[model samples]
Target: MAAQLSEIEVKGVKIPLIYEKSTLMPAVNLQIVFTHAGSITDEIPGLASLSARIFNEGTKTLGSVEFAKELENRAISLSVGSGNETLVFDMSALKSEYLEGLRLTRELLRQPNFTKEALSKVKTDIKASLLRKESDFDYVAQVELHRRLFEGTPLEYPSMGNRESIEKITLKEVEEFWKKRGVLRRAIVLVGGDVELEEVKKDLLSLLSVLPLGEEGELVRYEAKGDLEVKSVIKNTQQAYIYFGSPFSVKNLREDSYKAKVAAFVLGSSGFGSRMMEEIRVKRGLAYSAYWRISLSKSVNYSLGYLQTKLENEQQAIGVVRELIEEFLQKGITEKELEGAKQFLLGSEPLRNETLSQRLSSAFSAYYRGLPLDFAKEELHKIEALTLEEINAYIKEHQELLQLSFSVVTAPKE
Candidate 1:
């Protein structure tokens, strides 16, 4: 059975909690959504990610060792993470010690020390990561593609921030950013597993009722603005990495967005026999692999995809991929393809919702986007009811994808 979910407000902050009973099991999981703290709102490139990474390192009330001991003694696991547009605090514990686990997670978030020592270590780690990224063509192609498409915006840079940016961001800046971003504003807390709704609600209110309602920070929502042009970073490498994309905008939970998803699968995201793979790999044998997919979110909308091939044939490989996209856009999709894609999605739903963690993540995303907790399930219904004509029409009308953009990291001309 699906977990029972309820919505409640604590001190005017709406939160969602999912309840599932396991009489034999004694664990509960929590996924706290920190919406405004995502990297999109970062004043510096990687401040949000770095701050989130070190958030659980220690607190003013208790040092790192003590915090570790608290969790260890209770058999709890805690993790802090941030992506392009969201920060999350995830914790799990035996039901017997769940309250203590919650208390410690709350303390770590509410009163981090931001010690110079902790900051130094984290900076070193981030720097090492950035250095490693510099040598990776895959990372280079991905970052450069975003830079080309999202220039002059926060999304233009990497979520981890670049070396110079992360190095220059001071402890003071991180703390200030945290003070403003890490609050009740645009926050949705989701918990699922072996617990009751009321007890979790009561405990959460006690833990965070007094948090300052911080500002909802801003970013210019991403749009497709670039032209069909290839931006290249000439690296001394054996293979050329290529990414093709165009501006794509469809809000979360929309009926058409579901159609767009099916369209994407039929066009490129589906493996092997899909259009991109069939043309660029199987038929021509130009590259070992090629794939495509739509990248959508509340903040930005775009199609992003990648393939790698021998440097000498980089332009040829890119040409074939573009032709595939152009043809797919013009021809739309067949009834057979649409039906297959729908079944692929519908069959995959159970696998996705098999655990409390996955359901909590989905519910949190919906709630973060100001949709009801049940929006994901409803959207699937939309997908199921979609007709071939409807999705094909969606593809036909969106010819703007023809003016797609490209970014390549390739070996320099000999």
Candidate 2:
């Protein structure tokens, strides 16, 4: 399918880039990202997402149930989700429902009630969710990892706050968070598939006109301390979940970042071919499943690689993982491994952009992170262009920088 990219400027708000695809099925993907500083971070880390959820719960005229029913009636899927840096509200619907969907979305964004009842329900739901997380070994491990890695920083807290924080939150607090950070800043709205550009622009303006523009707040910059610490969570279970890693931040989409990504895939990310999978699962039979993930934070340019394994081989597993990591760091990756990583990354690129939702979401994230709208495409190119020497150099530079953190879920020894 042929694609054309274009930009639209309305008033002071500039819609960065839009990719239009001519298809038989009519579909529109819109991404609206709001930029607000972390004022609410002091109270609750994920206050931005909490505020977005409350806004969707009810507006001035529609109650929670009514709003949901209206959305269902239109066969529209409205999703309110966020990342560490921004809150994103995405909508997908047929051409016929686009106008109404946009209208309802605008109402929810501009006229949220933030009523006491809504706040109570949200807190109650969050508390219940937290209760359920207590028994989840993987969740425990991940949470402990963040706590150790980002100690004393606002990013140390989970995106979903703890039960005590949630319980203490009030409607007034929610309102204050909204007023301080939710109203206006830089907002990007993306609409794709079978839509008139002019109409979409008008719809966006109508909703955005009600929002007041003010001095954009300074961006919150997070710096990762190179200190690595270990933590353990005691629980009465047969298996334990363990994670360990170090701070690897990508500041400017550098070659090191790309090499690190490729190296991580060879080390753990590709599921079957990764070194972690081969050693932990295939060779040793130590874990039922073992893999690694590369988490990138655009605002802070922080990236971390994590390895999750079961408790039976917790100590041994960490030891073996560390040894392999040390070897990679010292000797660096081979030509064969680099080639395999590149192929795996290039093969997976298409999957990332397979759906309209993925495309729009990726575009929004790229723009939000101060990257080109074609960041994904660029990433693929970068991966393809990587050399074995560069990958080896990255490993040589960062091998000793690794950190270890633990979360154990096991019964006490007799």
| lDDT leader | 1
| Alpha carbon lDDT of each predicted model | 0.79, 0.68
Question: What pairs collide in candidate 1?
Answer: 224-247
1-414: candidate 2 lDDT, tens digit per residue: 423345555456454545555355776767666665342254666566566677678676888889889989989888776566666677877888888888888887777868888877777787888899988877877777677667787677778778876777777777876666554455656677777766666677776776665546666666555554455777876776776656665635534556668877887788878887888889988776666655665545433444445555667877777777777678887788888888778998889888766777677666666676777887888889887877777777764346544444455655
TM-score of 1: 0.94
TM-score on alpha carbons, each prediction? 0.94, 0.91
lDDT of 1 by residue, 67-116 (tens): 88878888899988998888888889998888888888778777886988
- Model 1: residues with Cα > 4 Å off, grouped in runs: 1-24, 217-220, 251-253
Please give the lDDT score for candidate 1.
0.79
Query: Evaluated with TM-score, which candidate comes out highest?
Result: 1
**Residue 409, candidate 1: C-alpha displacement in angstroms:** 1.1
Off by over 4 Å in 2: 1-22, 37-42, 226-229, 301-312
Please state the error at residue 377 of candidate 2 in Å. Answer: 2.4
